[model samples]
Target: MHPRAGQTKKRTRIQAKNEAKILEAALDIFATFGFRGTTIDQIAQKAEMSKPNLLYYFRRKEDIYISVLERTLDEWLTPLTELDPDGDPIEEIGKYTSLKLKMSQNDPTASRLFANEILHGAPMIEHVLKGSLKNLVDEKAAVIHHWVKAGKLTKVDPYHLIFMIWATTQHYADFKIQMRAILGDDVDQPDYYEKAGQTISTVFFEGIKPR
Candidate 1:
């Protein structure tokens, strides 16, 4: 179902605001309940709006779910999109790693939601995964390869390196419960993210620096 705003009419400020609210509420609901288990009413309640009013923006639960996923993907990929080909390879990669880890630390629900979608085969976003996501990763992978060819980094499979960075950074979010359990209260310390970022950067840089 197309969102009501997509009907060739420019959305008013109020309409836009309501749509944002609905999506934010829907994200929380879908993340907790899974897509199949979430309902339009649940989203409406979360958004603190009437069901009919919420329906004015999103026609179905699936539409809202897809919108939430798309928004998450856009935010999730913004750091990668900013990767500068002309920048120093180690610094650029380190910055990207820190940004990703910060996202995981600050918004673990978004990470777990995305991870769950992928684990279920990404039925709702398979095309996006195959098309835009694959294309973006390919573009960044080339940047990594260029750095290596310029003797800026050690030899490594660019694709696998990208995958490795994603896995290592997102683990903090996707397995927060397990991590907190094992690490005790240290994970809750004020400087935990700072330390994690420094440790990740050090490990990645040490392994990839030309040897």
Candidate 2:
């Protein structure tokens, strides 16, 4: 029988550790080679597990890849879900931008993985995107739309605004090499996220604020 996650039996703790190790290795391999380019053998080798042993946990490579992606997508979009409708829109957007830029710098591999998914039309996350994602955006856009209608903010395309935020924040991840080249190696420093996040928050909040 499958053991409870936290209630690991003698064999289960080791099993859980192995699964985490495998997932970590898989992240690095899949981030570098992408889901289509990676192989079960390569992942097994990276995780230092036998092919059959890895298979004991994950039935297929797709299962592992999808599981990794599910986690990544969940994290990638979490900031948006935290936005409060009653909060000041500027602060809300600023905070979201900061959170996203921080993620871009902190977990670049995960970002690239998600990017690859979207680049391929998000086949794995298409349902989530069309469902939970659309619902959140639709709700948030209405909030922004209401602000504009109430003269609290300048009129802007709510969907486009969201798209812009996503594209801008994710640029640091999706185009890290180019960003590093253009922004220089300081972009990789420990405080880089703080400085970058502040700048993004400034640019977006200032540009979007009403007169």
Candidate 3:
């Protein structure tokens, strides 16, 4: 028999400072260097722990990276899942804008880590992309289809819409040095996310909202 979803999926907890510190260090380390390039020793040093102690929680560098991704992906896709199929399209879009911007601003490390994974062709996470990520995309595409059919939003390729969202939101994180040099250091200021959110939201909602 197939295992139940709840049974198969376990959650993470940051019950203590050390665990949180470890994860924070792991996130920064993985983001700075791609998975193949990061080392357990580096992570341990960053977290102020010995390699053996870090290994107590995460067996390998891959495990730590996956943990960070799991936590980040869960938070990242939340805005989509929060969209109320029955609610106003404009409102949902606004909420998504803020949520996505917050991820870009507050969790740039997580974003870079994910970007690094995909840039290298996602050898470790292709399975996840094919499975859970693909499933969620298909499900949301169905909702977006209804909006288009009902004349609530513009008719656009749903897959490409998703891709646009990911690409636009992740650009600052993935291309930090270039973006900073071009836009100035304040590109990451708090207002930066607000401005980005508002700009993207306006551009999208204006184009899509039943005109």
Q: TM-score of each candidate? A: 0.88, 0.86, 0.83
Q: Pick the candidate with the highest TM-score.
A: 1
Off by over 4 Å in 3: 1-17, 207-211
Ranking under TM-score, best-scoring first? Answer: 1, 2, 3
Best of the two (1, 3) by TM-score: 1
Q: Which residue pairs in candidate 3 have backbone atoms (N, alpha carbon, C) closer than 3 angstroms, thus clashing?
A: none
* lDDT against the true structure, each candidate: 0.87, 0.82, 0.78
TM-score (C-alpha) between model 3 and the true structure: 0.83
lDDT of 3 by residue, 15-56 (tens): 256667888898898899889899999999999999988877
Off by over 4 Å in 1: 1-6, 207-211
Task: Give the per-residue lDDT of model 2 (tens digit) for 81-172.
Answer: 88878888777877788788878888889888878888878888899889988998999899888877887766788899889888988888
Query: Cα RMSDs of all predictions?
Result: 3.0, 3.6, 5.6
| lDDT measured at residue 68 in model 3 versus the true structure, 0 to 100 | 83
Please give the range of 10 consecutive residues that has the lowest summed lDDT in model 3.
1-10
